[model samples]
Target: MAGATLLPLATAGATAQGTATLTDIAGRQVRARLPARRIVLGDGPLAYVVALLRPDDPFTPIVGWGDNFRSADLGGYLAYRQRFPTIDRIPTFRGSNVGAIDIELAISLEPDVVVLNLSSRAAAESSGLVARLARAGVPLAYVDFRTRMFENTRRSIEIMGEVLGEPVRAQSFLQFRQRQIDRVMAPLRDLGHRPSVMVERAAGLYDDCCLSYGDGNFGELVRAAGGDNLGSHWLHGTFGTLHSEQVIAADPEVILVTGADWRLYSPTGDWVNLGPGADPSEGHARLRRLMQRPAYRTLAAVRRGRVHAIWHPFYDNPYYFVALQKVAKWLHPERFATLDPDATFRELHARFLPVAYQPGYWLSLNTDS
Candidate 1:
């Protein structure tokens, strides 16, 4: 919003033979040859959506990608690598963000199109990389799974599907996604009590008391699951920090912490390692230790053991509907007693992913509850 001015969809038109003009989530028109053979991922996690669209071989079209995936979600990375050993051979950039990308190297890959996160548009434009890529005839597309997630996820998936020549697969995944979402939202339409909730973004990854979302990402999931996101009242942007005192004052009814295997990023950090094939016993122990922090130790949520830790990557992926369903059940167990987020995730893997599904994505302090 601060840098490049995106053109409206109305201004975009058809392209010539062997090419298609697409309106990315950022409202920018990108003209790339159909079924891009060589793609560069500005953010590695985007491979999650790519996997959904190209179940047989998600990494085939990708020539290069960012390095965040290995460190951000190590378990998932390992799982995929196990199934596709060639993943390690793919060229990886140093940073996941657009600004940190080596534009010259990305262009050198001769990618048919480069997929970047919508949140990086300002940096991409400010650095003149967008214009340079245009000059090099490299189509650049924007997709969002983090900032403005709910509003842009569907369009972003559709854009990728078109780029990858898997529109039907994309539609199927979208329908599945919608069904999962409706499974949680439809019953909450006449909700009685919206639990006060706080989702600590990257909870134990940092030493800070609280880092959270506001009206977006996990915060949006909380609301969709029928909970009041306390961070929305303070932080104006999609992400920001909340003071410990403010958190104490809020006294949320439920506390949700986002976490992942951070050994690569923070070798000695106090974070919950939760992801594919993660150890629930160890994850539960970490969650218990994290709740001991002053900011949470005194909260009613902690006292009543209504605190839970969910995979941090869900805040930045299309699989968020699974998190939404899990959160819904946590917020209103009685209403969603039959809901099984784990089964839904398993089905997602069996139907669309190349890797097998593993159990340790979410853990609650009070498993019985």
Candidate 2:
């Protein structure tokens, strides 16, 4: 990390009154003062707060964080870097949500509040990271964008808003999120029968068969979008590996593969380059290749040209409403024939994000090459 000025959390916390007690997603009580000026975000997913609350200047209050975005979502990092060229100055800890966290180093940064994901709370506590932070007098705020998101995402957003001194903005964003969701779900309420959709998490990020979300993240998104997630029936946890044989057995009606331009991480990998300023022709080519896999050829989705690829990062962020629209569009094209997910995404960027809008976030096999 590049241009940063470290300050003591004690001084920042002293500026406010008594500590505010809030219940985290893990149902644990977190005590922290209001308007935390110095923050250390646990994983890259918490970056959603920065984009939503402080989009104009996200790096200002951020003292340190897990540098997952730079590695997992390079396009998003590049966009932030373009605007705040000095973001690299902020100190960062190694690892994402599931990785081993450096608690001692995080406390050394002296952040008044440390925001983590509820899904990773067990790992953090098992490693004694939480106790160390608590001993150092650094309050931890646990938020979640996955795992029962429909019921908890708003609470997570509101908690961040309250801690960051933007309660109004947080509530407004929740309203906006609900509206986006209603736009897709309202019409599908009276409809019966949902397409069995399979979510391929981080497609091509590995060398083996495939990984996917079971009951969380993209699995939840597919359900919300009026589709039956195959993972929900077979797997028991948030994520798990699905063998090619398992996929062939399920024969999902819609195969939705999550991908991104991870060429920097895997130059010759089969991942699709789908993000801002992405090329449709290139995405089509990559997705077509995935469809040609032996097991995929035997799947119903591929035979009917219903296979699709979408942005991978949507699995970790609060921008899932956008994913919902995209999923709905793919699961039932007839009902959503006039729906424009790209237009909705552009509206979100224009209203909330500092960056300009771009396409290629998602596409279907049937789309013109």
Candidate 3:
């Protein structure tokens, strides 16, 4: 289609004009002038998005995280940060309650636009958070990341950049991220090896549960890392428990445990004693010891020292680049010996992340005293 043409007006005190248009998902052509600064991010990837944008984008004058403290994914993020320094510290961004945001708070912020993560429309409608924000004349745009598709990781970063007027930065970041993932996955493509793996979550208290990842998430990470997931076919949530029988039946080629106690489990409750936390060999020994337990001893991975602990930082946040690097290298030593993933992770965490990277994190398949 030809571009829309503009006609000059004869009226006095008139400014020059150009035709500009944008079409929303509903096919509605929104013909309007450009937006001004002052934006509010409803919840979800807002902080991450804000961080990716160059420091000078005035558009996101004010950002909000919304009431997402209840989400399981968010919980995973919090858990890691609470225990490990490598997981980037989550920045503070305000929002309304799960039911509705406090209007007065948002009004004081006075944003021009609002972006939302409408994963559960029901949650939004029930609380009226979206409706009230809309009533305030804040335009809301929803972008899905958690579920709509796994690829939305890059998409979310791009959308945040678009709104913040830092498309170049976002593009560069994405390219860097993709290349890192490719490097991690490339070595595994040709190898006919798969480590039957299991991921367990910290249930706050009580015994930990067996968490499984499917084709969508870190399971993809595991596949790229060159290991078969034992609990994967059993069909579990991203953070869920599996029957002991289920774990034994799969007979994993490798077991990757995640918990604050992982590299450093103890009868007493202290985490620092675990390996240097950055030393892969120390962590490796820790995992090796855990595999020797009577029940785990039957597993082939335990018998052959195939288990290792990849410190569970970078579970979320932009630090995903670091997590993938460590996980891929941990899974495929022969293929990625030159990668030096830990050093790369340390640097990325030091540069892009808000927190400092700690050492002796990723461990072997054994337990340490």
Order of quality (lDDT): 1, 2, 3
lDDT by residue (tens digit), candidate 3, 1-369: 011221111121232333334333223243322232555556643454554353222113444445343132343334334434332422233432334555556656666555655453456567676677667655555554443233566766665554554556667667767877787767766787565676543312134335445553556566656766554575555444576667777776666665343322334321222212344553454445555544366877777766555434334345465566766666676777888766765554444443344555555554431
Model 3 lDDT, full chain set: 0.50
- Residue 261 displacement in candidate 3 (angstroms): 11
| Top candidate (TM-score) | 1
> What are the candidates' C-alpha RMSDs?
6.9, 4.8, 10.0
Give candidate 1 misplaced runs (Cα > 4 Å): 1-17
TM-score for each candidate, following the candidate numbering = 0.94, 0.92, 0.65
lDDT of 1: 0.85
Root mean square deviation (Cα) for candidate 3: 10.0
Residue 102 of model 1, lDDT score:
84
Q: Residues 267-359, candidate 2, lDDT per residue (tens digit)?
A: 888888777777888888888888777658778788889888898888767888888998898888799898888888877776677677778
Q: What's the C-alpha lDDT at position 138 in model 3? A: 53
Predicted structure 2: clash tally: 3
TM-score ranking, best first:
1, 2, 3
Candidate 1 vs candidate 3: which has greater TM-score? 1
